[model samples]
Target: MMRRRLLYWITALGLGTLILASTGYAQTLSQQVLNLLARTNTWTADQTFDNLTITGVCTGCGGAGGGTVTSVAMTVAPAAIFDIGGTPIVGAGTLALSLDTQANNLAFMGPNGGGPSVPA
Candidate 1:
């Protein structure tokens, strides 16, 4: 009986470890998006700057008398938002932004080899 109990405990521990180990391979949607962005460099960071001025300080940059100060304002594009557990639903090779795995179990509802359509 003692040996059987030990075997049961070992089996339980092994199963628990296996379950936890399997989860490590599965990445969250946000993590996947971040990894993709880092690799692809497709998105640009958002930035805002105002009243920026530069003055010469180097020996060859010339003295303050010869330097000029300029004011400028700039804005950069914002990054894309990655919704949690978000998955794309494509139909006829077109993405249906309005459809998701949660809302629609089957994302592809059109006939196979059908013509392309505009993505949502």
Candidate 2:
């Protein structure tokens, strides 16, 4: 009986470790934007991404430029929802985004009428 209990405990511990190890963590929207900016200052061609949500304050999501001009243009297809600072901005279709770091500005051009300009 003692040997059987020890074996059961070992098996349980091994399974638990395996399950935890198999789990994966995904990066947040803000983190993804920052990573892209780190790679390049400007995005020449228009980029597209899946539905994303921005939670906390997103600093530097507007690209990065000290004194020079920097910009990024991308499209969020299907649907794009932004929940930041408790404010929710929801949109459908293709959501076009233009970011100018020098001006600390972010513009959104969605389907139908044009979108709003958000300060970064």
Candidate 3:
């Protein structure tokens, strides 16, 4: 009886762990934005995302002397709302924006443009 009970407990524990491990959890919109902002490397490929809510202001993303250029090519889904700087706006198709802090300039790039205005 003791051995049978121990086997049953072990089986139950194994099954529970398996179930938990197999379950997938999706990241929240806030988490996704946080992850994107945390990225330090340049993205070579394009990325697609659903609705994005960008809150708060970036104090010093351009580093010291403001000579940093960050390039991103991302497509927001159709009918998705983008909340930037507390302003909510609905956009269709791709939305690309490049920020060049070295020159203190920002540009909105459309499709078929000569890449971003920022120096590579």
Candidate 4:
């Protein structure tokens, strides 16, 4: 009974909020958050990536179109070090990314340490 009441209240609140949305209001925050990939900015630099670990969802064949079944997987890897020209690009940075692919603003990049020495 309590669960039903809570659901009822939630539904009602959602409906009320939707109805009360003013015409003057623009895009919703939830819509923007869902559009992260759409909003990603493309970045390109002489990025020497090391100690890199990328995190993102991967979809496999399944669901309505039947195929091999499997669970969600999490992958990890160790960091590395390398050089780009005279500038030693060490640690993970956004060099692999192209400014066209990533649609986000090119914000400030943190200093990952660059010297003549590239750590082994």
Candidate 5:
């Protein structure tokens, strides 16, 4: 329910901004969209992990562990607003994504695992 509500709000906010821009209140709709994207700090998302391997590394300690077949959580942040040459590009926004965690979100894992304890 919470996830649904959050998604609804995000969609509503985006759509509302687009509508405002489209109605010629200020800037172009496309530019407004770009500005919105460029202004967001970070957005996170959850995803399934199927046949994917994650690697862990410890510098100086020379310890590493990695495996395959698990779950994945992802977070993305806005990249540098300016270009490599220190020039601010017009209407350019990009996201830098990082896979935060790996585990399973299946029915067998119970409610904590992301699924119901029993089949619904």
Candidate 6:
């Protein structure tokens, strides 16, 4: 009886760890948007959000200053979102904004190909 109980406890503990490793705490949509904005070589971060939708301007992406950001947003995650003055480089034929908070950095590929921006 004792051996059986010990085995059950061990199995339960392992299962719990598996679940945590798989599904971490949820990320707000706004935060994800801000991350996309900061990566641009041109645009400066006007605002940040948790949702996928973003609104920003581009005045110093790479040029002296000529871009304007009246508003920025997308119905869904766009292929890419560059800074106010940044150029949107297409990766893997498209752009995809993804986020992973697994303590390890997430790969924010333009579409779908590459490793994490940071090792985390």
Off by over 4 Å in 6: 1-23, 35-38, 41-120
Report the Cα lDDT for candidate 1: 0.28
- For model 5, residues 36-70, the per-residue Cα lDDT tens digits are 45454332222112321112111123247866533
- Model 3 residue 116 CA deviation (Å) reads 91
Model 2: per-residue Cα lDDT at residue 37: 38
- Per-candidate TM equals 0.12, 0.12, 0.12, 0.13, 0.12, 0.12
lDDT of 6 by residue, 63-94 (tens): 55686454433333332432222224333233
Per-residue CA lDDT of model 4 for 1-120, tens digit only, reads 455432111100111111112232323234333233224343222212232111221122135765653333222232122222222234433333112333357453646674466779
- Backbone clash tally for model 5? 1
Off by over 4 Å in 3: 1-22, 31-120
Clashing pairs for model 2 are none
Worst 10 residues of 6 by lDDT: 7-16
**Model 3 lDDT per residue over 13-103, tens place:** 1111111112232223343334454352332222223432222322223455755334434444331233223123344234444432333
**Per-residue lDDT of 31-102 in model 1, one digit per residue for the tens?**
334335335333223211232111211112223576543433222322122122222322323222332234
Please give the CA lDDT of all the candidate structures.
0.28, 0.31, 0.31, 0.27, 0.31, 0.32
Candidate 3 TM-score, true structure as reference: 0.12
User: How many pairs of residues collide in each model?
Assistant: 0, 0, 0, 12, 1, 26
Q: C-alpha displacement of 111 in model 4, angstroms?
A: 2.7
Clash pairs detected, candidate 3: none
TM-score, candidate number 1: 0.12
On TM-score, the stronger of 2 and 6 is 2
**Candidate 5 error regions (>4 Å):** 1-92, 100-109, 113-120
